[model samples]
Target: MHEFTVTPYAVEGDVDYDRLLEQFGADELTDEQIADFPQPVHHLVRRGIFYAGRDVDRFTAAANCGDTVSIVTGIGPSGPMHLGHAYHFYHAKYLQEQTGAYVYIPLSDDEKRFSKELSFDEIHKHARENVRDLVAVGFDPDRTSIVVDTADADVVYPLAAEFATELTPATVEAVYGPPPNVGLGFYPAVQATHLLLPQLVHGPHPTLVPIAVDQDPHVRVCRDLAAKQRYDVEKPAALLSKFLPQLGGSGGKMSSSDDAPSILLTDDRETVREKVLRHAYSGGRSDVEEHREHGGDPSVDVAYQLLFYFFEADDTELERLAADYRSGDLLSGELKRHAADRIADFLEAHQRRRPDGPISEVVEPYRLTDGERDQLSPEVFDDV
Candidate 1:
């Protein structure tokens, strides 16, 4: 067995995803389960960007039958949002559109504070920018709620406190590795609070958390807490995806902290092209003539994988591109240009729709309602 480590806080070395599923004990999504998703499924699901899951059947059943369903996918405000972050949120929006699933997005500034080198001011700034990008995704305000951990600590903290009692220090260290600070020791409880927030507000309902496969430990720990039956909540199901490989071809998760430039949400056409052409790993032969004879390998081509994973949604068209690449008809430069163009197009639309105004004003409508705050933390409210 090749040694690799995957924790919510870090993913190191090349991950064996099949082995990861076994280690995490999550079920691979079956064909039948895929069929259960509402019609016109997002390409992410169809193409296996999201490959494995836990209790997906129950969430699909709820969606199929018009029962209350919620999606909880969050971000730590450690940096600007990148294409990898957009991938998860965009899929959540697609499901919300199809099934009218309530969507809850949490901005874990607290976690960022504990985990990153940034100050609270810096973290909050990123959180605000992330909110703008999220609002631009166009989640239905009527059904969508966004919570910032510190901004909404009245509810978040109390709820996390309730779950913290159930978490042992050994278990936290085992899953997340050692905590850098006391805040991290309790942050898993905050994550548990995020997963179960939908149920806390609207009563028990099927909730799905779409996240990277490495983050499954967070879902598993939360599931264990829910299973204790202290809270009136059902365990949240998870949709796990392989990492969106970084541009450097390391096969690790795309991250803003990487040495190679990440395709940021703010990148313009020229910036996108520059990054893709300069940094994207090529799977072609050393010489152009050799590449023409043997063809490029799309399996290891960063550009092709980008298009296949999320940018190129058309099944037939994507397959045609793949065939052409494998047959030496598509050169590495041409494929990189194509992927950059597609990515730029997507970002253009997102930038156009991005919300403007004081972050406070823009976020108020999406924040938890006063009544919900009271419900989740009457003691805190009473103190106020």
Candidate 2:
């Protein structure tokens, strides 16, 4: 395929304070908190923070080893699709197109138990909405597929069951929440099943999952299951993105539920600008004059973090901003101004280039007949 340069980089203020709340056990964070989890283990992998302890070289070589590369990602229509969500998919699209990897997206209706109250039809409606949103982010229908978990014939579920049987609960808890939900207890199994779906369908033998840091637990679960698979599951790899903090807070990260901290991808440019200027966390000089003269603390500024993802430029520009802002030459307004422009540019470009329609073509579950489903070994479903 086409090769896009993948580089090591950081976005300023990409810290997700609310998400961090779960990580640090902090109830609240003042404007001063700026640190994030340890740097992602692999610098070369596109967006490394979200990945577990994977080395990029191994992934790169795997991409090389495969006759065709398959990159897997999933989404549940729990809420609207935001710019933050696009970051992960866009990176995947770039890497997939560059590496000639086929993008396999699971529409993840099966996991919609989160909105279980909704009728199957209603659940599917939102799932469809999520598909349009992803298409808007530039996925090529011909290149990408969307698989609905519920519709898959027995062929996929049996594979999924066998896959789930391999994971242990301790492994799941280690990579995710403290008091794990019973739903989450089985999360790894489902995740591994998703990763391997393509393989069962005559696609790539081993696929990779790309996600953000918060979803690291899923991959952690996969890694653990891979060890036990002697031959049972399709062990997958992943790429993780670091979380970007809210507009102004530092405690945790942008949470789907916290409207105050996020600038939704659907937000208009003017609204985006307003949020960044007024709400984006600031690391500038305490006073307007001091910040302009001394330059801003890029570390503390949410705008910088967002720009790291939106700017599409090298680090030198950020350093320049740092120098100017510290000297009182670059104002918070200037940072917001640039951030707004880049964000606006990104959104518009994405809208203009959004994919034509539903990724259903790419994600259609591997259909199986009743006979095939019945043929599945009962042993595969043994509760782990």
Candidate 3:
């Protein structure tokens, strides 16, 4: 057995996802659950990129019944948004479109400051850029709300303080080690607030959080808080996902914080091509003659994984590519080029939709409405 560590802060070793489910106490997403998703299931869910969840049945039941459903998926704006970030966000958009689910996207600028060396200004700058990328995902503004920690502290802080009292420092230490500062000690509460915000504003409803498996601790903590029943809310369900393969082919999660080259959402065609051809790991034989004789392993090829993960959505086409690669009919360079082109195309579409205006204006449509603010924290607008 390969020894591995999975935490919200770090992931090390070759992760055995099934074992991770055991360790985290989350249920594997069964075929029944997947089928329960709105017809024409998303590639991410259908393909098993999102393979595990907690309390998923409840959310699915509400979604299938046309009851109110909500999705809480967030980004920590410590760096640029990458392809890894797009899969879940796009999946969230799909859920919203299919089920009329409300989507809540929170940018944890303060948490980034607590963990990373980046200053608040730098994190906020990234937060603005991240919001632009998220807006490009084309969520229904009426049903989607984007909240930033510092910018919305008027409501975020008050709610966090309420939940913070219930989240003990010892629990924080057990989940995530001792914080360097007091800010992080209280972040779990804020995260709980993020998970519970929909219920707080819209009243109790089934809320789902689609996140990487490592972030399950956040959901677990929030679930514990919800179990206390101090508030009228159900435990937020979680759909946990496997990490998108990094360019380095180290079998680790792709992250902007890592030194590995990430396919940033802003990269152009030429840049993407260069990065893939140079950095993408290959599973081909050392020489062309040997590769043609023994065939390449598409299962281990980073290029093929990219296509399998999200870039290539057609199952037939993906299977064809994989079979051809296994037969040595598709060369590694050719596969890399194909992945690059597909990725560049995705980024181009996203870039085209990316709003170009002042940050406030770009985010205004997605901000929590005055009525919502009053519901979550009426004191913030009491003077108004």
Candidate 4:
């Protein structure tokens, strides 16, 4: 068996998603399960970008029956928001729209601090910016709650503390390797708190986490905690996806830390084009005559993959572009520019909706309400 790392803190080397299912004990989503998703499933699920999952049927069944269902996904505030981050959130928003599922978006500022060389102040700055981007995603303010781990410690910490008891140091080390400090050792508990948050606040109903495949370890750990029955919570089901390829044409997760440029949510049309044209790897041959003779390979082309993964929503149009590229009628540069234009259009609309007011005012409506906070941590509420 080839060894590759897949942990909450790190993902390296090429990933075999099928093997990941075997290692993680999750099932590949069947067509029937995909169809069960509220009518008109998002292309991500329909096209199998979200390939594997644990107990997806349970979540879909709940959604179909109009039972209380929730989607929990989080972001680490070590860097700016990128297209890869937006992919899952958009899907979450789609699910919320169709089924009225409660959406909990946790800004893991504390986790970022423990894992990265960032000051708390810097992490909070990123968190605030991330909140603005998330707000723009248009989740129903009434049904959505965004919690920053440090800012919402009154609820977050107490819940994490209780779950922390179940996690042994050995388990943490085995999954994440030795932590640099005590804080990192306990971060998994915080993550578990994130996954179980909906049930913890509203009582156990079906909860699902839509995340990239590398992050499945966090879901697994949290599921174990829920299975203990130490708290009145159900294990979070997962919808696992392949990494959106980096612009450098690598078969690995995209990252802010990578040398290849990432297209940030804040990038402008010109900047988007600059990055794609300059950095996007091409599968077309060097010479025009050779490219026309051999055509291009969409399988290894980063530009086409970007369009396939999220940008190009129209299936018929996407197929035309793919077919054209493979026939060498669409030049590599043309494909890159086409993807850049589509992405810039998306970001422009997203930026237009992003709150321009003070962060506190914009985030106020969606913060956990007093009563909900009390449900999670009455003891901490008294001190606050």
Candidate 5:
């Protein structure tokens, strides 16, 4: 073999590569980590529901490809979920109701970690709120099935091990390329079995793990093992979403843990408004005359992001306001106030719909018994 080349590029300040990675936040997944999935209707995406990445089309094509139609979706309860998480559930519920697919939802308790400074007990406790939030987002009681991994820590391991043994360590190491932790190796098995849980929970069925593309590596691992299975785990479909930015910065996914950039699922009206007005990036100028002449940056403007991601107002109404804002007539204060008021009001309405619901409450009523059966809905399947 040729000697390894140490190709040099322009050097910045003394680079402590590991320290720099720490200084700059990033995920470990590579460009190829994501799987290709079926493209669901754009409206399904806009409603903030069911998401997988490149893996979606395969699931869609398979459903039409064969006689069976069943799906699997797993949730990570490692941390309390946010509006971002709500999107996935809403979409899953929609697909289940429409298609009559056997639906499986797994709560990933084993994967949770407390704050680096906090204990596991704290993280464990937070799982309840996550369950509540998921329920409130409207997972139906009659149509869905649920499993929480903590119910029996070993419940998932047997299946996961079966998947790993079949897929082999060499195979996993080849696909994922060892790094981060030994856990990632098994994470694929855990993830694969999760998508297959509906089949495991009910019976032989087509399963799909509906999730955001950020979790794509997990799906690739799942698809690989499924292909090698005694059973088929057709490529899990991924419904993807664009990441929402922090209120104050262009980088970093929004977090439930932070107060400033975040307007949480649990935030009260005033807190919502205050967070928006105080921290939202603006589309208006620093001063009046210059702002009117040049307008502002819509890409960085927090209010605009909310309007695009969360607003329920007519598209035309939103479009008119966006045009005016870009023209410099709209002040940042005015836009922030409008967005905060609307977002707070919308969240309050959602909270009211399921007064007693929380993720745990949601998961409890929908929990599935092994060998249980439910009819699939016809709505989820498209004739085309």
Candidate 6:
């Protein structure tokens, strides 16, 4: 068995995702839960990319009843957004459209500064670009709220301060090793604030946070705080997903911070094609003759996995590809090209929707309203 390490800041070795659920004490998502999702379930959920969850039943139940349900999913603005980040955001958007779920996107620029070597200016620059990509996802501006840690400090910090008192140094140290800086040590509270923002603004309600399995710690930490009953908020629910395979096919999570080549959201069609053909790992035999004789393993093929993950939504098409690859009817190069073409098409549509105006103007519609700000941090707006 390969030893794996899964943490907020690092993922190493080939992860045993099932083992991770046992380690983290989260439940495997049941079929009933998946079926309960608004009709025509998301590929991520229907196909098992989002495989496990914590307190998911409550959120799904609320969504089914047409009750107010919110989803909190975020990014660390350390670099440009990539395909790995897009699926999660897009899934949230789908839920928003299907269920009228309020979406809260929090940009953790401060956390990136504390962890990475990047300057605040550089991180904020990435934040602006990240926001552009997020706005491009076509979320309802009235129902979606985008909060940046530094930019929205008036609301974020006050809530963090209150939650910080409930979080102890020992607990923080245990959950995450000793912090390299005080900023990271205090970040859990800020994270808790982000998780609870919807409830704080609109009163206690079910909130779902869809994140990769590695980010479950943040949800757990926030759940513990919410369990304290000091606040009138419900424990936030979580939907945990497997990492999108990197171009190198190392089985590690694709990340912008890593040295491996990633398909950035801004990459043009030609660049995307080149990256896949040159770097994507193949599960076919070493020689074409041998591959034709023995067939290929679509399960291990990066191209096939990409299509299975998000690009090809039709179940029948995906199954046909798998069968053909296993029966020597599909070549590795052909599969890569197919995946790249689908990806390029998705990116082209996404890029076309991207707003070209100033970041401030683009993000204005999604910012928290004065009433919400005042509700979250009354002290900041007291005299106004």
For TM-score, the strongest prediction is 6
- Residue-level lDDT of model 1, residues 137-220, one tens digit each, is 989999999999998988998889889999999999887778889999999999999999999999999999999998788899
Model 5: lDDT of residue 352:
77
Evaluated at residue 167, the lDDT of candidate 3 is 82
lDDT of 2 by residue, 1-384 (tens): 222211111123334434543552323311111112112212223222343324333445655565555677877665667766776677677666656666767766655563344456777777766666676666655556566677653445666667666665555555554432465456457667667655544443446676655555566566666667365544565545555566655534565556565766667788878877877877777778666556777767778777655454555786677667666787877787888888888777766654444456523332333443455424456677
Worst 10 residues of 3 by lDDT: 375-384
RMSD in order of candidates: 1.6, 9.4, 1.6, 1.8, 9.6, 1.3
Per-residue C-alpha lDDT of model 3 across residues 218-285, encoded as one tens digit per residue: 99999999999568899999999999998888768987756668989989999999989998889888
lDDT of each: 0.91, 0.58, 0.91, 0.90, 0.58, 0.92
Backbone clash total, candidate 5: 32
Q: Could you give candidate 4's per-residue lDDT for residues 1-384 as a string of tens digits?
A: 666877778888777787878888899999999999888988999999999899999999999999999999989988899998999899999999999999999999998888889999899889989999999999999999999999999999988988898999988887778899999999999999899889877788999999998888889889888999557788899999999989998678888877888999999999999999999989888988888888899989999999999999999999998899889898898899999999999999999999998999999999999999767785734555
Candidate with best lDDT: 6
Error of 6 at 248 (Å): 1.1
> In candidate 5, which residue ranges exceed 4 Å CA deviation?
1-52, 58-73, 114-120, 152-154, 170-184, 201-206, 257-259, 355-362, 370-384
How many clashing residue pairs appear in each of the predictions shown? Answer: 0, 38, 0, 0, 32, 0
Residue pairs with backbone atoms closer than 3 Å in model 6 (clashes): none
The Cα error of candidate 4 at residue 39, in Å, is 1.3
* Regions of model 6 farther than 4 Å from truth: 380-384
Error of 6 at 115 (Å): 0.4
Count backbone overlaps in model 2.
38
lDDT, residue 11, model 1: 88
TM, every model: 0.97, 0.73, 0.97, 0.97, 0.75, 0.98
